[model samples]
Target: MSRLTAAEQKALAERVLDIESRAVSALAGRLDDSFAKACQLCLDLTGRVVVTGMGKSGHIARKIAATLASTGTPAFYMHPAEASHGDLGMITGQDLMLAVSNSGETQEVITILPLVKRMGAKLISMTGKPKSTLAKAADVHFDVSVEEEACPLNLAPTASTTATLAMGDALAVALLESRGFTAEDFALSHPSGSLGKRLLLRVADVMHSGEAIPMVTADVSLSAGLVEMSQKGLGMTAVVDQQQHILGIFTDGDLRRTLDSGVDVHKVPMAEVMHRNCKTIPVDILAAEAIHVMEEHKINGLLVINEDGVLVGALNIHDLFRAGIV
Candidate 1:
């Protein structure tokens, strides 16, 4: 069914990528005062940005709306064809409409312009034809015109859609900086994602606390510390003073070393075998930071301390894995 050889197919694929890349690159040099004004309009809006388009442009519009919403701007996509069927009610007077159409003359998109104006909403249009109805009617216009389509026949939307998506990204990043959007803010919008877990999960949230903590008094026998570690399943036991302040930690590695020296586990005290001045983390630090501490010290676990230097909890690499932080 195919007439082209393998080499011809590869050439076609490369040409598509080349044309699309150039289309997006050209948009970088065309940025003007209108781009800034567009960002400002979105930043200053009291309500959301309502993006709408038809056909292939609609797909790009939906992505742009999602990007805006996730990057500290309130925005959503509205189907242009469905707008006339009562979906226009989603728009309020405080909202701004971002309409996308390569030709700027899409009938469904243009039909809602009069209604949007009567409702007192501002308009921003992304289009190839600056003089087309949709572009001329907007309060601000972004020209996404390209040299030509990447389609071999120069008819498909290949290049224009890529240019429009790049322009939308430019608007989003500019607005993100102007709004002072931080990673923590992004975590709030993506609470179910891995970044949210890294940013929002705290040491206290994952560390074993109360009776579950593997702890032993410094005067306890090394054998007794081993029993505590086995019971708590944390691979190590914290050695604490009577006031609950951490003294040191005794791990399985310490056990092997003590055994090699022919020391009796039943006779040696935890204070004699424990590692002194071991790493400890604050309870309020991020769980991600806990991982960093473990890696920095080349240890498998850490003791958690409160503001008063009291050992309150403990956690190991296994805990990080269970919490999806690893």
Candidate 2:
């Protein structure tokens, strides 16, 4: 045999993706009332979706379980051989079983069907053969049949596994929609994920509160604002009114410009040198959104305000970095 040329490699890769795409496309056509029923079973389930299979199907099963769990359906995968040993106890009467086997003759998978039935858990089978033993034993059957494997020899599992994974995603997404799974709901499930942190982390949670906030009165001398800025290490201080309502903001840069104008720091009020009409954000806004605002405005910090437009908090670029929003 000779080494494959670059052109030939490109052709083969396309062939594989084409075959898998066809397989997944056919799955969408095969979806009918049975697919809906599988979703209904899983949607109504109080317990998790117990996914089980062997070899290639097992990997697909694990992926299916993860997608299901992430999208709002509670789910997990259990190895068939392990299930027969002792892991079977993980399934409960309220749970649903999603068994994936292309040939429908995986002995380990079939061996657990009766036990799953004994637990009063609903079994949904995804297989190439509708008349196969596993399909006949299931409460619902989804035809995950593929015309051919992408493998040239037609021996390795390729297109069939892709179809099963696609079908599992379809099922999970259907359940997600039916259950009205919102972004907030998904965030709660994935508190440590990037999307979760963006939606759930509020300015109040990450902003400098109480003594950590840099503050000064409008009547304070420009030199005094610098002292507050240096002591707080926030690079700036809030210039507030007599009642502490934010009138403007003063920073180290403001002090520099005022000094260049030949003004006395001790003589000038902070209000005279502070930036009027400064942009501010609500204290309830997400920290992720704060990053976007700061980037858009080309600024490194923000003044947090309440409903009455009073400054309640202060945050800088370093705060977003600490919260992993930067």
Candidate 3:
């Protein structure tokens, strides 16, 4: 094995990045009526977008399909080889077919073109060569051509694949905006992911409600508040009035400050030692927003109140962690 100098390695990496970056940028100028027609084709379709390619193009096709599916478009990748065997049946008249090939002459993809057309599916092609048979056969074509591959030999699919992927992203994003897709809609599609937890999980969903909430009446002794905080294990207890309206909050930090003042915990009322202007949030806001409030105020816990300003629940940083909103 041979090792290159650090300077040589850095130069080579930068050269590749420069080529790929230029290739992606060039795609912006290439967008015209064809791009708009392609987007409209996908938007007008009643079925999923079926993406297919061979070799290196197939790998990029799979990623493009996944991105489209996650961003509000219904899309899936069908292997050209598998389609030639039997998977071609997946294509329906309602689908929009996106065929990818740098040379635009992949035999595997070309073989299924006739069957796809016979099924009344609309065809879109992405190819480096506009004159290639695959591009000529499509109803709409996108030129994913690049000046040169990032590879030293210009043989590997480098700059061309990067351009194709970027083009795919542009298509998905344009469609996402056209359909008025929101972050909440994206979150619903990805319910098990971190973004979903942040956008879809509300404070009430993870809050400790009912008897699980650590609370004590304003008249309760500081000793009793400590017991409630310990029992609920939230590091804080809400001090409420007789009608369950929040008056103040006592936390571990308050206890430390009281100790410094030499106050007797057994004799002091919770309302006297508690923070009078504690932060509160409604139960319907995003849990992620609650985390923002906590970070801004430098507090670990918050009291949850309803529209009537009555305490209904409580949550801390730990709850956010458990809900994957942290």
Candidate 4:
């Protein structure tokens, strides 16, 4: 086997990247009124987007559909060959069909065109040949034609596939803007993900509530408060009023500071030592917001209070960590 020199390898890699990147960027010139029309159609889709394609275009179509669904566009991939075998039942008249075929002719895909038309499903096509039958039949046609393939033979799907993938991105992002989809909407589609934890899980979802809450009255001795803190294991306890309103918070750090100052834990009132203006968070606030509050106040735990300013519960950082919300 002949070995390539360093310059030879570098030039080949640069040429491949240059060709593929150009295939993607050249799409910008093609993004005119039709691209806008495509986005408008997907945005107005009351039903799911049914994405279909043939050969390498099918692979790209599947990825494009996944990206659309993950970014708040309702979409799913449907194989055209499978459609003949009864997968067409999955599509409805209200659905939009996005078909992809580079040659603008794939017997399997073209065969289903009549069925989709008969069902009254809206049809969008992506093809390299604008004059192809697929493009002629489509309600919207996204041209993914490339000047040349990255493959030296110019036969394999290299530059064409890259252009198709980028066009799919353009469609998904355009639709995303028209829909006003936010991170919160994206998180709902990915509930088990870290993004969901940061966006969806509120303080009330993971906070200790009801009997698990650690509470100690203002008149309670420091030793008794310490016992409550230890038993609850929250590192802190709320000091409440007769009406159950939060008065202050006594924490382990406060206890340590008091001991160092030679204050009498047994005789001195705990009220004088506790933090009067402790950090408090409402139950409805996001757990990520609660983390910001704790960081800003230099506190590990916070008092959960209702609109009436009554102490409802107590929770610490460990709770959030355990709940996978931190």
Candidate 5:
């Protein structure tokens, strides 16, 4: 190992970045009919895409497989070395093989080419050597060749690997768009992630409903509304008609205002003290949208309504926070 001055280290790092950036940029021109064919083959496949590679390429292949799977194309990584040792059984005639090899001659990957072909699986090869046996055997070839490696000695896989990863991203994104994959679809693939929480969580899933909802009739005394609010622990109560149709909402703020006006809590009706025209949301809307509504109205809670404008549920910022939608 060799130690260098801080300035020399920075300069070397910048050189490597510049080399890898240029290598990825060059791949844009290489996207042509072959790239389209590769994406189409993936799209038309009835089964999963089997991504295979060896050594460093295997790491990139695994990532590409994840991207493809998460973006709507079913895919999984199959280690080339493991494939020769019976993992090749994972590949089916309905599946497609995406092989990655910088030199286009990784022995582990090449060794399975015959079996993959015999299984009638489609093959898409990414390689620097266009004329290598792997490239020739592939149904479609992607040229990820780079002028040179970012490694000063050009003996390590640096720029080539970067280019390969970029190409894989390109393929994943192109296929994602072609398949009309939406953010909600992506969320379904990542239900434990924050984006999934925002996209899939509906107000009904988090709101207080049924007997848990705090409610008071329009003619109910303001003191009764306060009692309902206290019992439900929502800091507010809906003023509704006999049919549970929301007429207005009385919150802690409304109570403070009513008291400031010297209104007697025991005498004043909820309809007289409550806030009409309160912001309400449908029970089916995303909880994230509830946050937007609350922020827009400068309020801390919301009334969830049904299709018939009936009060179905209630939720506050605290509820959203508990549900991890905040």
Candidate 6:
């Protein structure tokens, strides 16, 4: 055996990519009424989309099922062999069956078709051979045929699998659009992920309120405000009035400025040193949005207020980081 030279290897890799790219592009022309029908079947399903296949096709089927489930379609992949072994009980008449087999005659998948049909499930097939038994048996057939595999002997399932995956993506995205699925909906399905945290976690959910908030009356001495800030460990304190209305904010930076100006910290009032027009965010906004506001203003902390302009909560850059919003 001999290894190809670097230049030869690069050329071979490019050729393979080009072949797979063309195969996926060709599927655009194959989209027809059958594709629409398949999408409609999935859209109308009240039960889960049951995806099944064998061998390499089964791998692609699992990925397709995941994509569908994440993008607002309820779906799961069932191994054909397992389905034949009483797992077929998972499928219901309200479900839609999506079967994948490049040759359209994998014995395991073919053997379970009748049982799926007898359950009155709508059948959709993805195959490289349109005339094969699996394609003919399905109520809707998606042609995933490729000109040839990227393999030298054209035996490997390369281009065909790429085409099949692309078609599956198309179906999932079409259904996603028809259902008016939003990024918030996707975030809900992925609640444990960083994107979900950014989209779903609100300001009030992670903010320090009541006794946890570092606040002082506007009439308090600057020295007292600094003590409140230090005790709260948030590096800042909100200066509020008797009615709990935010008058201003005093942070570590304001303390530094007061020291430089040679003001009497013990005698001067907090209202004299606090930033009267400091940034404030609504309690109902997303924590991600609060981070944006902090970044835009070059501030380290924010005062959360309600619609009536009463101080409700307080948060800082560290809080956002702790909440996985930063």
Taking all chains together, the TM-score of candidate 3 against the true structure is 0.88
lDDT of 1 by residue, 241-308 (tens): 99999999988888889899998889999999999999999999999999999899899999999999
| CA RMSD of all predictions | 2.1, 2.8, 2.6, 2.6, 2.6, 2.2
Tens-digit lDDT string for candidate 6 (214-303): 999988899899899989999999999998998899888888888999999899999889989878899999899999898898988999
Clashes of 1: 0
TM-score of each: 0.92, 0.88, 0.88, 0.88, 0.89, 0.92
| Residue 219 accuracy (lDDT) in model 6 | 86
Candidate 4, residues 91-131: lDDT per residue as tens digits? 99999999999999988899999989998989999999999
Task: Give the per-residue lDDT of model 5 (tens digit) for 1-326.
Answer: 66998899999999999999999999888778888888899999999999999999999999999999999999999999988888999989999999999999899999999999999999999999999999999999999999999999998999999999999999999999999999999999998788899999999999999999999999889888899999999988999999998888999998888899998889988889889988899999999999999999899989999999999999999999988887
> Mind sharing the TM-score for model 5?
0.89
State each model's CA lDDT, in order: 0.94, 0.89, 0.94, 0.89, 0.93, 0.93
lDDT per residue (tens digit) for residues 1-326 in model 3: 54988899999999999999999999889889988899899899899999999899999999999999999899999999999889999999999999999999999999999999999999999999999999999999999999999999999999999999999999999999999999889999999899999999999999999999999998878899999999999999999988999899999998899999998889999878999988999988989999999999998999999999999999999999988998
192-272 in candidate 2: lDDT tens per residue?
887788889999999987888888998888888889998888888898876668888876676678789999888888878
lDDT of 4: 0.89
Task: Report how far off residue 12 is in candidate 2 (Å).
Answer: 1.0
Q: State each candidate's clash count.
A: 0, 0, 0, 0, 0, 0
Which residue segments of model 2 deviate by more than 4 Å? 241-247, 276-282, 288-300, 305-311, 321-326
> Candidate 3 at 325: error in angstroms?
3.3
